[model samples]
Target: MIKVVKFGGSSLASAEQFKKVGDIIRKDETRRYVIPSAPGKRTPKDTKVTDMLYHCYGQAILANDDDDCEEYQRSFEDLIEKIKERYQEIIEGLSLELSLDEDFKVIKENFSKKIGRDYAASRGEYLNGKIMAAYLGIEFIDAAEIIFFDEEGNFDDKKTDEAVAKRLENLERAVIPGFYGSGPDGKIRTFSRGGSDITGSIVAKAVHADMYENWTDVSGFLIADPRIIPNPKAIDVITYRELRELSYMGATVLHEDAIFPVRKEGIPINIRNTNSPEDKGTLIVEDTCRKPRFIITGIAGKKDFASITVEKAMMNGQIGFCKKVLEVFEDNGISIEHMPSGIDTMTIFVHQDEFEEKEQKVIAGIHRAVEPDFLELESDLALIAVVGRGMRATRGTSGRLFSALAHANVNVKMIDQGSSELNIIIGVRNHDFQPAIKAIYDIFVNTMI
Candidate 1:
């Protein structure tokens, strides 16, 4: 069995943290294929190494008279030097007697002079990878050489697959950096924020590992935010569909698009805590997974939303009413989040920010395109998503959710349940988000526990 372990920025922030990660990795040999993220903040007041690089390079773009690029270079050097010093300290602290050479001095010096923003941003992972490999005495492989991107900056799966396959075919284990792959022009291109999560999935797919372990700060995916619901239930196992629904609403574990590559291979990903390895964490898997006793897995939600309601007689029969309502959104550069409707009324959910600066135009567009006797716009709304795969298999999950909310004296404004039955989204007053989630979680999870 092979495990591809990807450490988040927090796990690899300093030499001390690096030593902890090393001990975790060394505890099990199956954790051979490793992915490292750039060092993150050592303290609340400190800035991330990657963020510093971005600001430094961006300053270079805007450096008029200050010639701050050189100064930016010093901050950059300080960040890297700090990272190196941390690693060297880890090695010394652990007394590993490892060679921290062949990097930073020669290879890094040349690249710093002619590096693009993506390359600069990627150095966090590169520096962390070097330190981790040196501390662990493992082979260090650059991700840019393996993770391939196309001309338009989209990832090239075919080429990346072939490269990673060939690279890891002979070698059973090594430390590979995450994020920032090579572009078609041989320059560097990076995935958007949380790109390291994407890199871990890609590598998991490339090597066909049995499981991918994402070691981060959290123990696992919780049913609800602790701030919202104290002692929230932990989802022992969740299907991809359930996870996706909750993630979109506001689940904070992995990026919403991070599991695409490995999803197809049927490889399960574990969200583990580097600080607390004993925790079972959360197991994300395909629909075929049969573990977990809860009929409703988790609840996640976000605040600050607006809902536009349109009502017209014979609305269900009207051919162009839906199109006109959507056109209103399209014309005003607004995107609808959820659409729940009845025979004569339809509600379009949208982020408050989308409507804040452009609500009048949207309302005017609706009036002009699809005039209705009853049209109303409401704001200061929150959406709570209750997710579970088993909810579909067994009935009454929706009934239980509404009943729970009712008992808690929480008023729900709108509800949208997909045809897939994986999640039920309920719109409530922004003030009710916390109580509503806690109430529902208590009924579904606490009753079982």
Candidate 2:
């Protein structure tokens, strides 16, 4: 069976880390394709190679624009040396006879020419991919050659899949850098941060791998944010639908975009810990027949949302009422997070940051569009999602959730649940976010113990 493995920056931060990764790959011959990120922080205080590249590139841009940029030039040269030293140390530690001198020369020239930030950011993965390929004695495939983006900078999925499948057809083992691809103009373009996960997923789909292993520092995804619930229980297996709900609520073990490609192909993704390779970690799949160990798979949430409540008589009977309300938000360029409505009451939840500046305009728009009996706006709200497939089979899950919050003295401002019974969302004051999560964790996870 073929496996596609992607290692995060922390897993490949130093020579020792690289050695650990080498062993992990060598142990599994079926792991034919490898994806590597740029070197991450070596220590808590250390800087990531990607950040350093950005800094260096920024300095280069300043030097080109300003005639009196001697200081910026010096700083740029220093950063370049520092980046080189980082690679040199890894090469020495691994005792590999590889040279990046020519690559650096080309990079330096490109930087001086004011190459795009995407190009600058992608260097980390490119440099690391070279080292990884050399150390493994495998072919190095540049991601730009296979991954494709359109003129508008949107990822061209069909083109990318076709290119990757054709390119890897003849290769037995190869190392491809993550986070970057060539646009229609042949210029480098990058995804938002944490894009390497998306790259790994794309590769897994193209090759139709049996499993995609994502190695990182953590053992697996936890049922609750560790910060909220100390040493929270780990989720052993999670369905893609459950993961999406949790991710949307702020759970971040895997990139949200990463789920789509592999999900369509029905390939399972294993979240493994590189530091502790023996751990089974979390297995994310499209669907599963195995029952969840807990009544809830995970609890995740975010703070600082604002809610607008519109009250109107005979609202349920009014045609185009909800549509008009939604159109106001759409015209104002504000996305609604959740809208839970009753017979005459409808509440719209949105990120506070997105709605704060345009509040008055939206209020006026709503007044003109819906002509509600009363309208009220409230801020400083947080939404927590209790998601699990087991929730459907278990009775009184919502009752237990309300009980937990009431016992914790956390006021619930709003509650919404999807028809699928896959997730229940509760909105509370920002300050009660932690306590609310703790209470729910105790009810669903700790009580089971």
Candidate 3:
């Protein structure tokens, strides 16, 4: 069995932290393949090394106007030197001899396209991978050599599959850097934000990893936000659909797009805390391998949503009513979030900030265009998502959820459930986010799971 473990920056922040990481991996022989991120901040006030490099690259491009090339070269070289210095310090602190001098290749001076921020952001993983491989006495495989993109700025799945299969099939135990890959033009390219997570997932899938562990600072995903619900229970196991709903509503443990590759192959991705490995972290998978235990798994919510409720007799049956209503948002360059409708009324859910200055104009436009009987705006709205896989086969899940909320004396404002039945979203007052979350958690996770 093979395990691909990816350590976040905070997990590798200091030599002490790196020691902990080494201990964790050594304890489990299956954790043979490792992916290391650039060292992250040890404290709140610190800045990430990747951010510094991006700024240096920005300065390099801005000052290339002199034509003598010294300014650009010096600026770029300064960033490169800083990268090397960071690794040097880590190696010395850990009392390890890392061969980064040969691996750390400088970006060519006159290269016209610097490959955008992806290339700059990806160097963090590259440098850390170099240090980690040396510390572990393993080979370092550059991700740019394996992950590929087309000339038109698209991911080449076929090429990447072949390259990763060929490469991993040959290596026994190695560290592969995450984030940037090579495009068809043979330059560094990257995916969307959190590309390192994407890269790790790709590697896990390629190697057919038994499990993919993501090590971060936090213990794991909670059933609800602690800020809203004090000391919410931690989720030990969650399904892919349930996690997607929680992520959509502000869960931050795992990047949403990072789950696809592993999910496609039915591989379980574990979100664990490097600092406290003994704690059971969240296990994300397709479905319950054990049993149907709970009616609901987690609750998450976001604040400051504003809703515009429009009411007119037979509004759903009216000709061109929806088009006219949408044209007002189109004219203002605003997009509706969720539209819950009925025969007489429809409420458009949008961020409060979006309608800050244009509420009056949008109202007037709707008055003249759609001619609704009444148009009113509700602010300070918070949306909560109650998600689980068990609810799919369980009857009265929604009824149970609403009953729980009602028992807590929390008045529900607007509710929406996807026909998929994986989750139910309820809107409440921003002031009630805490009580609502705690109330739901008491009924669902604590009582049921």
> Which residue runs does candidate 3 get wrong by more than 4 Å?
65-83, 99-115, 289-294, 318-333, 357-370, 392-410, 445-449
RMSD of each: 2.7, 0.8, 3.4
Candidate 1 Cα outliers beyond 4 Å, as residue runs: 59-114, 289-291
Ranking by lDDT: 2, 1, 3
lDDT of 2 by residue, 1-449 (tens): 88999999999999999999999999999999999999999999999999999999999999889879799999888999899999999999999999999999999999999989999999999999999999999999999999999999999999999999999998999999999999988999998888999999999999999999999999989999988788988999999999999999889978899999999999999999999999999999999999999999999999999999999999999999999999999999999999999999999999999999999999999999989999999999999999999999999999999999999999999999999999999999999999999999999988998
Tens-digit lDDT track of model 3 for 1-449 = 99999998888877888899999999999998898888888689876777776776676666554557677767877777776677787899889965667655654342234546667777778888878888888898998899999998887777887898789897889998877788877778877756677777888888889999999988888877877676877778988888888898888777788898899989999989999999878888988765545567787778899999999998878889988988998899887777888889989988899888898899998999988898889999998888877778888878877898889888899898888888888999998877888888887777754
Top candidate when judged by TM-score against the true structure: 2
Q: Write the per-residue lDDT of candidate 1 for residues 222-285, one digit (tens) a residue.
A: 8888887767767788888888888888887897667888899999999999889889799899
Instruction: Give Cα-based local distance difference scores for all models.
Output: 0.83, 0.95, 0.82
**Candidate 1, 147: how far from true, in Å?**
0.7
RMSD of 2: 0.8
lDDT of 1 at 1: 90
Which of candidates 1 and 2 reaches a greater lDDT?
A: 2
